[model samples]
Target: MTSQTTEATPDGGQLRVSTLELFFDLVFVFTITQLTHVFVHHPGWDAVAQIALMFGVIWWMYSGYAWLTNEVAPTSSGRRGLLTLGMFGFFVLALAIPDAFHGSGVAFGLGFVLVTCVHTALFASSGGSSAITAIKHIAPFNVLSAGLVLVGGFLHGWPQYLCWALALACQIGSPYLIDTSGFEVRPRHFAERHGLVIIVAIGESIVSIGVGLTGRDLTVGLVANVAVGLALAYVLWWAYFGIDDERGEHALSAVPPRERSRPALFAYGYSLYPMLIGVTLAAAGIQMSIAHGNERASLAAATALSAGVALYFVGQWAFRLTLRLPRPWTRLVAAAVVCLTIPIGVAWVAWAQLALLVAIAYAAVIIDDVITLRTGHHSSYV
Candidate 1:
């Protein structure tokens, strides 16, 4: 269940992600884009529910590959070639996402099923009969889920929803079908891989904001907005990688396999909750700035932006709390919730607006960090 080998730290070994990993990640970028677009088009609680379901699907695919790559990558040229082939299916599935539930669910389902099969084969080919047998336990379930997706794609309304619902259930439960304890997953490597991917997601958010900034005509307010936005991004980066990531890395480094696995799943793997929300809120904030003033603000938009900021901090809190690291992160959560209240309060206050709310919320995060530092409460600090 454990291995003597330890992966090199980011500095000790190459920090560069491999070409194949980048190519594989490209598909996920496309998938996130599709989910964003689809969610935007619908824009309500129902759409949020559907997007949540789709996100589960996305998370499972990525999680399976991550574990597989951690175990078997660099072991064989043959496996690497098949990985490239699997990435192709992922690309197709991503491209089919916007239409997955809309126009061509069949195309999406088939592509997804194909990707799952490819991954299943790769895992089965891992080491011996145990690996094959372990993977096979989950493979049939994947096939059944894929069939549901295909059938769901063909139907309309509730029937389609039902198919996807069942499919998602199967997908989420698939991990339980195997004695995952036997997998030779080095916790440090797995955690580090996911932590890097999250950075990639956050980088995309910065890129999105940068792109928006470039196209707009600059005003005094616009300049201030840009500064605040940049500051906010930096704080988010600090919140994740600053000390939290180190603790996660250390936890994985110190713990036995069974205990170490939880951080990867609950802490790193669930990061989409924050990453997605932060990006969406930050994007909406950019558009709000570009739109002359807060004239376009709606309760829905305000709530979305507020929820996004809140979730990112909550995720940070959860990441720390789950690992029982240097800090409890309770103050961080309190600050985040207090900051998030700005948007709701703005709805009632004449002077309060989205831009101002963002500025205040972001400032609070910095203040909270400063206080934490001054108090020297973090275990990592000592």
Candidate 2:
């Protein structure tokens, strides 16, 4: 029961991401907004850990769908229904985030269970034999991790963390637990899908600036500070979109399928998880920073502001390394430099700290461009 329509683009060699896929992503970004607010409402160590644990589990399935649909697009009515159900699951998770560690844990877990189930069924039904085989090996791990999340929801303290930790461990180990060499990855759709996700996350960050703007008088300084925040978002957007995404796609496409699992998984899955976290953290930071542009930062705001940008570069460093792109010294240096600004953020005004961080980000982009020119691999593998 596939759709009468083909998933292929008019050009025929690649698949265009469907409108339904884009609609599904709207829910995913909503989850990002909710996760961002978890920190906004409660800025502390607990909030940070909860975000880490929750994101790890949530992303496993989110990225899993990207992989699923790369091979099996929801061109069919049946697949679309299943995907829409999965989207509802994500919306439930989004609604649960503020209270995930409190009263809403069960609902969060239930949503996760639903997401996992739909993902497995959707992938299992529509894939070719090899993909089905891959999903067969992968499905049990997914089920077990979802179970842990549900069990963790039942508990209330350190015990809950342990269950979720175990769930995260299972997800991390699943790729190694089985042979994933049989997994299919078409470079164009895969890269485009991920690129769209990344952009959505960045867009959410910009949305946070607006959230921060609420209730503030429209002043010149406030408007200027907001402008700088947008600049930071733009530079981050350009860094990924300018050359690296294309490079990533080109790198994966250059490799045969048997060799793609590692690079593809790292580029989109493992590496982007932390990168997305970084963006979320930065968004929260921007929200807080914009509210007090003239005042020195609080500990949470300082850490989020400095470390968020640093974490993004660290993830980018890993992404480039996994793709066997140039050594990514630029990203490494940018990461280190941004981290050093936490204390400065605490000591100086929020605008000052943000300006400094954006400067470092802009510098990294210039260096990356220079690297691309020297290697002549700006858009190619080699």
Candidate 3:
């Protein structure tokens, strides 16, 4: 936190994501894995709500650190050590995801509190008066929210959820409550950090496919399902990175300094909620479908797989809107088509349903590519 502002500022040219930062991200790989596990085992609406709340807290911790790193260079050994310590907190939080609703809620709550405390300390020491001011406003809310999470851990059922919800409300609303004008965001670093996290989430989806298939007897049907799963994951990757990735960075970079926070909040901060949720849901779907390959899908499984892809498309559209870029109709149509397939998918075998989901995503990417080629523009709506 110690005002390494001079070293951290992008005035030294475009700031790049550091190796330590990438190292820190490895913790979230486990976090997402646990989330997919939770969803696959407990796909009920109540479970989904709990997962979403947990994800909100986890996302805040991750994104908060990203923002912190963007402002403060972890160049010194001391700073790097602090980040590593924070990583341990996240790792512990990931471990608590399974029992977060029941057995080990206290551990989960305390882990989150620890991470947020580190974030507040970093912000408190990093910038000048503005950073200190932000710390003053945000730190108290952080403590209060952490206390709520801890208190929620001791409660059960609806009351527990209520406390957790109140805690998340404070974290989510804090950005607007505090004055961000004093802080500086290096657009390149911020954009790249978020994009990399998305990539990690995608990797988790890929891992889910493998994890689901582990130790199963390999057959032509299972093999086919695996291929389709990989294709779906690839299409998700291509859909986002093909057009939006670099453009997103440029969009953030182009925003006026004084006004940059709004777009950053919209494009990266807020939009990422759906993106991460979609990716997690998609991973859960892949696990369910792959595990039940050759069997007919349940409504829940079909909807999870289909709705996951649809949600991803919706998220991409929102991201483009945030950037003030044109939304591709192909993606919107793809979302609709995927949703329509829930019924079709329910009647079809799991592998076939997966194949259909893959087709929808692949078709969208292909159509977007064709439109880009024909019009010399990345988005058809442009």
Best model number under lDDT: 2
Candidate 2 residue pairs in clash (backbone atoms < 3 Å): none
Query: Candidates' lDDT values, in order?
Result: 0.62, 0.86, 0.80
lDDT of 2 by residue, 89-195 (tens): 99998898899889899998999999999999977887877878999998999999999999999888899999999999999999998989767788888888898
How many pairs of residues collide in each model?
0, 0, 1
Model 2 lDDT, residue 255, Cα: 94
Q: Which segments of model 1 are wrong by more than 4 Å?
A: 1-17, 74-76, 127-133, 210-216, 270-296, 326-382
lDDT of 3 by residue, 1-382 (tens): 1121324554322277877788888998899999888888988677678888998888877897887887777867777788888999999889999889988888988898889888888778764566567667777888888889888888889998999999999888988888766556678788878988888999988999888888898888788788888888888888888778877878878888777877787778788888888888889888877878778877777887888888888888888888876555666788888887777657767887788778877887777777666876653222
From the highest lDDT down, the ranking of the candidates is 2, 3, 1
Residue 121 alpha-carbon offset, candidate 1, angstroms: 0.8
Models sorted by TM-score, best on top: 2, 3, 1
The TM-scores, one per candidate, come to 0.80, 0.95, 0.93
lDDT of 3 at 39: 82
Instruction: Estimate the lDDT of model 1.
Output: 0.62
Model 3, runs deviating above 4 Å: 1-14, 328-330, 378-382
